[model samples]
Structures are given as structure tokens and as C-alpha cells.
Target: MFPMQFALKRGMKAEMPDMDIARNLDIEKPRSRSNSHNEILTKDIAGALLDVIRDLKSTLEDSRKSLSHSAGAGCRCSTTGTTLSTLDEYSTSGPRSSDMMGIPPEIMSYVRTFGHEPATASDLMDWLTEFEDTMEILGLDGQNGTLDKRSVVARLALKGKARKVVLAKRAWLARQGQQLSWAEVQKSLRLAYRAHIPEHAMESRLCRFNPQEHSEEGTGLLIQRVLEIMNMGESHDNEYRLFYIISTLPDDIKDILLRRPCPTDEVELIGRVEDIELLKVSMAMNGREQGKGRKR
Candidate 1:
């Protein structure tokens, strides 16, 4: 008998105190009792043990039947063997699925689709921001997997001419025995589309930005737009960008900002201006509230 079978039989014999079963299984016999008593006890124990074994067999058969009925449900099984084999296969075999490369539906829906003709620097940058956000949300932003896999999934997020450009670039890399990466795809797309803009145009847009016209957009967005245009231009001078941004601000806020020491960078300048704008709004609200209280 197998070790498991032997152990199970021994356990039953030990629990029931059956002389016949003990002798059959080579277990040590218990002390002898009166003949009549031994006969009664043996019968009762044997009946109970048979009932237990019968119930166990019935349960296994029920399980086997259930598994057989569901065999077509992509679960591997074997009906030609013991219950153990079927159980083992049922527990272990099936298609292994993973979400490591899967993007959530919500994230996909939120990300903007690109591919329209005449992609501008601002449009590409905005789309790139959304793409980067999606990558970070999926935890694929770092050195998490092969560049090829990342590139493939990243391409799926794009459509139109943008997709075509990336696919062509990927093919070119393949010819050189190289795989395209997400970073390389981004660079390629930018160069093919946004890089050809005239520097004068970018500078012209920056210089003409009017914060007053875009007041409803809030100070932060206005500042961000200025910075984006400045980035597209050849000039890297923060002072020049700052000068243009300050010049565009409403005179009331600009005068207040001009009196303060100059900020170290555009970021510092943005923070200071936003704070000032918020303060101005708060004071205006307070003034109106005071006037209403006096009338009441």
C-alpha cells in the first residue's frame, strides 16, 4: 500500500479498536476482552468505519463528476486515473493571465488620442503630458520592462499620423538591429512634427501673450502657456521669459510684483504672482462683504 493509504488505514484501526483491521494492517493489537464484548464492539466499530469510508468515496465521486461536467471550461483534467490526478490538474492547470502589461480602461479613456495633421508644439506637449501620466499610473514609467514591450504598448495609446510616424521610426530601428523605446518614440515624434516650427513664430506668440484676455483661465495657466511658448523658442534665458511674462500681467498686479525683488526663476515668479492674485481676490471679496454689512 502507499504510505498515505497505510497511514489512513492505521488511523482508522487505531480509532475503532478493531482486531481484524489491526491484524490486517499489521498494527499492534489491544489487550483482550470477554468474547461477547469483543464481538459487539467489533461489529459496531466495523460498521462505523465502513460508513466513514463510504461517505469519503461518495464525496470524491461527486467532485469527479462535477469536474468532468466542467471539463470544457478551459480547465485541464484526466478522467482515466485516480481522484488525486484530477484534483491536481484542476488546481494547477489553466491559462495564466497577468495585468502587468494591461492598462486600466479608465486610464485609457482619460488619455487624449493624437494623430491629427499639423501637430503643433503645444498640442504635442499636452498629449505627451497625458501619455506620461498614463505611464506613471500603470507603473511603467521607469526601467520596469523591456524597451520593446513598452514601445509596443505606448504605440497602442496613439492613433493617426502620430502612430504612423512611430511605426515607421520603429521599423527603421529594427533595420539597425535595435528596439524602439518610449523615450526614443517621443523624441522621434517631436522631431517629425513640432521641431520644424519657426523660432520667430514661438517668440512672437510669447511676446504677444495677454494675461488680461485669459484672466478667466487663472494666473497659473496663463504662466504655463507663456513658459511653453518660451520653451519652443531658441532662447533659454529665464530673465527674458520672465520679462515677457511680467510685461503681459495686468498693470495693478504687475506694479505690485515689480516692486518686490526679482524671483530666481520662472517657477518662483509664478508662485509669487499666483499668491498675489489670490490675495487681491480675497481683499475684493472682503470689501464687498463689508459694504453689504454696512447697508444691512
Candidate 2:
């Protein structure tokens, strides 16, 4: 009976090794399946990333083409499409009046159209100044001849009512055998558009221009307005213009100006005012920053 029992126990021990092998196989099978699933997930992620990269590349290519097309067309694409379209109308090639006037596309591209309304007289003056500067830069100014380059540029620069007035003036001059000059065009436009205020009235207006009242417009604009008024009327003595501007400024600015010897000219005064404005802005920002630090 003892010998039989020993043989049975040995058989049971052999079966135990087979059961252990089966358990190990079952565990390894799941690990293998998990590794396969991970590989598939990794492949899907890589494919999706590749697709995103391809889409970005396509979009970038389209943007480049659009910008290239806009540049070749002589008008820049921008949020201000209407303005660009108006500029394009004058810039495009054709047997148009501007072309006949000898105005080049390069010049037209740089020149802005006149007679857009809700524009102040000061605005017109600013535009005229810019137009003259652009002409001078292009070597078109002071060309002595019947058809002056500056005159042609001025003609091409005008639009709407301003253009009509200038054309009438030009035609009249032509009938009298006199060619229109850039200077004449300037005078005509100023007379037609600039406010016809008397010299004394302009001086009064300048004196009344309070910088504090226009604080929202910034110091630069306030200075510009003062200078514009000074230019429009008969030239004042530098001392009087300086006194006028200094007296009308805010008390804080006036105090700062008084500490320095008076500026010799409007240009010098403007520089000083700008410096003071910058200093004040810096000090205000510093104060705010220090306040924040204290709260913290």
C-alpha cells in the first residue's frame, strides 16, 4: 500500500509542472496582444501627425501664392481692400488719362488720391506736403518745361471734386496758352478746400487751442495742430508763436517748459515738448508699477 501511494504522488508532481507551464503561457499571450495593440496605436498617431503636417504645408503654400499674386498685381492685399482697389484703379496699365499725363505706375503707387471727404483742411495740407515730398524723392520736382513732371504728378494725384476743379483750372490755363504748374495746382486746391478764415481769426483759434482739451489726441497731435495753424496764417515772429503755444499748454507742461531757457524756434520747442511728454509717460508707468509691487 505504501509503494502504490509513492507512485501516485510522483504522478501528481509531474501534472503540477504541466499546469504551471499552461498558466505561464496564458499570461504571456495577453502580454503579446498588448504589445501588438501598442504598435497599432503608435502607427495611428504617426499617421495623424503626418496628415496635420501636410495640411499645414498646403495652407502655407496657398498663402504664399496669394501674397505673390497680390504683389504682382501692384496692390497689396490687406484688411483695407477698398483702399487697395482704389489705388489699383490708377496703377493698372491702359491708355487712360493718367497714362497720357506721363505719370508712371511707380509714382502712382506711392501717391495717395485726394478729395476723400470728412477730411479737415489740416488733413489736406498734410496730404499735399506728403505728395510734394514723394515727388521730390522721385526727382520729379522743379522740372522746367511746358509739361512739368511735378504738374503731371499733381494731376494724377487728384480725384473727385478736387480733380474737377484742377481740370477746369488747367483747361483755362491752356486756352490762355499757359501751362498749369505744380505751384498753381497747390494754390487752387488750397483756395477751394482750405477754410477761408481771416488771419486774425486763425490767430485767435491758435490762442484758444487748449492742450488739455485735446489730451486724448496725444501731445504729438496737439503740437502738430498748433504748428499747422501757425503755418496757415501769415508767419508770426518765433517769439510770439512760442509764447502762444507755451501759454496754452497744460500747467504741468507749462511748468516744465518754463524751467528751460525758451526754445529758439518752433522746431526746438516741439522737440522739448515731445521730450517732456515722453518723460511724463515714463514716470506715470513707473508709478503704476511701484503701486502694484506695494500691493503684492
Candidate 3:
């Protein structure tokens, strides 16, 4: 064993020179680079795996977005269906057709006040068309007109239903012992046109029509005479105040004004300023003459 070890050392010493010579010679060693091709293949495989992973991630993201969109659409459809079902139930439970046919007499009377002349059938039909359109929008059909709204409205001047209403009103007025005077008619006209006139124009209109020269100038004069008769005197200031007072007139007086065929009272027309002083002077003169006769 000792001899073998000594020979191995001697051999290693001799091989050292050969090792040095081989190192000096340009000899190719058995190469780890033999496995470099495998390494390159592995790197290519890694790159492919990365590309697949990236594609898979993009696909997953697109799928997620599509699913979210589908979920949102489904939610909207369900909400819309529920809303439609609720509306359908409400419509089924609402008022019936027969209850919507009748129109209120008060509303009819208000329409009547728009003109002194009786409304033609076509006029009424046009009004009805407009009113029905309004009512349809409001969902107020099939309801009865209220009966207790007796605001002393005048009937439109005409035959048939309108004439009948006027006749009935006249009879009612007679029972109440009321007379439909000219003053009343004037007041009604004022009430009707009150909303139409501008505040500034009323003064000019009144000024243009002098009672002496233009008594029958226009409808304005009739209004002036009516104002005088009612003791609604000429004020120097604020013509619009007078108009406001006229506009806010009592409903009873307004009704008389609206009625046609002005009523008559047997008493002669007299102004308070003209009559009261005359009466006082006449009574004083009569007393003085009686005292003079007694002294004689």
C-alpha cells in the first residue's frame, strides 16, 4: 500500500508537466457549454409561458367586464318590469268611465260670463273639447259635479239650456225682491273686462270719452255712467285704485251686472249733491213765507 501510494505520487509528479503542457497547448476541454443549448431552450420555453400567462390574464379581464355588463343589464330589466307591474295594478284599481261624464254647473256659469250672447253649440263643443283634454291629463274623469256652489251666477243670454237658466235665475231674483238695474249691468261688464285692460290705458280711455259729447262713444261711457250712478265718484288720484275697487266688488252686485235686460225702478234719476241742497232750500223758503203770513 505504501509502495502504491509512493508510485501514485511519482506518477502525479510526472503528469504535472503534461498537465502544464496541455494547458499551454490550445486544447479544447470537455464543455459545460454542451448544456447551453438546453438552457436556451428553457429560456424560450419560459418566454412562451410568460406570453400565455399574459394572454390568459387579458382574457380573464375581458370576461370579468362582460359579466359585469350583463349583470347591470339584467338588473335594469328587472327594475323596469317591476315598475310596469305596479303601474298596471294602479290603473286597474282607479275610477270608472261612467263617473267622469258630468261637468260642474259652476264651471259652466263661469264660462257663460265670458260673453253676454249665448254660446252656440259649436262654441260649447269647442270649450268641451279643451276642458276634456285638461281633465284627461288630470285623471279626474267619472266624478260628479259639486251641487252646493250657488254663487249667484247669471245665465248666458240665449235659448235652450242657457235661456232656461236665465229664466230660472230671474225667477229666483224676483223671489229675493232684487231688481237688475243698469248700474248692475255696468258693474258686470267691468268685472268681465277688468283682467283684460292695462292699468295705464284705463285713464286715457276715460278721459277721451266725455259724458256730454261721447255718452255713447264706446262701452267705456256706459261704464262711466254706471260708475256715477253707483256713487263711485271721480277721484283725482290713482285711477287703478278705482279699477281695483271695481274688480273686488261683491259677488251679488257682480251677478246683477252680468244679467241681460237691465231692470227699472220708477224713481227718477237724482244725484245727491244736486238734490239734497235743493230740498233744504225749498223747506227753508216755505217756513219763512209761513212766518211772514202769521205776522200780518
Candidate 4:
């Protein structure tokens, strides 16, 4: 017998190795291990599921923070096409977008400067053009050739019907492999809301603004009134436009103008009309200052 092996005392049972003892004991496997492959696979899947759940929770928290910090808050949309039909409602009937909390302060403030509410796409385009010009003037588009847009669209009166139209445009633009820019989006809005003026109606309105009716009015006031009406008609003909302005002049002024050799160019004629108005303005200002000096 080797020195490491000790002989047992009399009547002592032979002690088996731990391996043999475990095999004979019919003991359950260690809690940390499993003999069944299905159980191990199940555990692995459960662990992976837990990880995904944690990641999703974290993502949701970040989204909440972003919405709270930005204009995207409360700006929810459904995937269905319900939002498209109501596009004009928010810009017209709904509350002012400038009054909303999530709207970017700059965009919201700029939108409120519109002379007319953007009830149609054309009105919105005008607003966008003005907005872009004002932004350029203020140096918002940076030296890096990029602008700090900062959810500018979200600040627009774009909820409900407007949002739907935007979404549809987005898909169409993507299909054409076109990148969506702020100006482009506004262009789409314009297409959606463009108004077609009838030729007959425009001509009628232009004719109805009679210069003779305003003969009793101040020279400046009559010119201003005529121009405003012309704008409402959206007339494009320079010759036609100049003729309207000239026809509105008081008979005395008209006679004086008619005596002068008319300029060949339509632009020159418009300039001449503007010059007469300016002379009237100068005379009126001189009269005001003279009255003020008399009081002194």
C-alpha cells in the first residue's frame, strides 16, 4: 500500500471517491448548471429579453426629455391620413401657433408678423419667404452654410391638417430622391394652397377701380387706393398696370401729365407716376412743417 493510502480499521466500509458517490447518490444537478439544453436556451432568451426591455425604457426616457426641451412636445400624429384634410384649420380657425409652448420662440414670433393669416398654401409661402429673408438679415443661417433650424417646422401652425399635408409631401419628395429643405417644404405648401384668379373677374375689378371716382381725394391717397386695388387683382401687365395708375390721376394732374411727352418704356412711365406722387408728398410735408413753425 502506498503511504498516502491508509488501511481502514476492521468492519469499516470502503469510502468511495467523490465522483462515484455523486453518481450513486442520484442528487440533483447544481443550481447554476443545467443538463437540459432547452432550459439553458430559455434562460438565455429571458436574459436577452430583459436587456431589450431595459434599452427600450431608456429610449423612452430620452424621447420624453427631447420633447420637453424642444418644440416637439405634444406634437403627436397618427399614421393614418386623417390629418391632411384639416391643414388650413390650424392656420385659420385654430389657436395661434405662437401661443403654443413647444413652438420655437423665433419661428412662432416671425409667423405672427404675417399681414394675413396663412389660410392657404400660397399665403403660407409668402410667410415662409418673409421668414427666410428676415432670418438671412439676422444672420441665422450660419457661416458654416447651415442653419440652426431647431425644430422650426414644429413651431409652425402645422398641427392637424397641415401636418398631414407635410407628411404626404415628405413621402413624395423621398420618392423623387429629393432632399427636403425648409424652402422646398414651403413650396409644397404653396402648391397645395395656390389660388387661380379668373381672367374675367380680374379684368372687371381692374376696370371698376375708376380714377374719376377718386378725383375729390388727395393725389397721394388716390394713387395709394388705386395701387391697392390693382394688387388685389394681381395684375401682371406693366402697360396695363401703368395705364390704371395714370387713369386714376385727378383731371388737373392728368392734363398736366398728358401734356408731357410720354416715356416709351412702361417702367419709365411707372417711374413718372411715382415721381408725381412723391412731389405731392413733399408739398404736403412742407405744408405740415409750415403750420408747425407758425405755432412756434
Please write out the lDDT profile of model 3 over residues 28-117, one tens digit for every residue: 333333322221112223233334334433443454344345545542223223222221222233222111112223333433433322
Location of the lowest summed lDDT over 10 successive residues in candidate 1: 95-104
Q: Which stretches of candidate 1 lie over 4 Å from their true place?
A: 1-154, 195-200, 203-223, 226-296
lDDT of 2 by residue, 197-283 (tens): 235454446544555555434444545655565455544343244334444555444434432222322344444454534335434
Worst 10 residues of 4 by lDDT: 4-13
Error of 1 at 253 (Å): 28
Go through the candidates in order and give each one's C-alpha lDDT. Answer: 0.38, 0.38, 0.30, 0.37
TM-score of each: 0.21, 0.22, 0.18, 0.22
- Look at candidate 2 and tell me the lDDT of residue 75: 58
RMSD of each: 31.7, 33.7, 49.4, 35.9
Output the worst ten-in-a-row residue range by lDDT, candidate 2.
8-17
Of candidates 4 and 3, the better by TM-score: 4
| Position 78, candidate 4: lDDT | 37
Candidates in descending lDDT order: 1, 2, 4, 3
- Candidate 1 residue 143 C-alpha distance from true site, Å: 8.8
Model 1, C-alpha of 83: deviation from truth (Å): 62
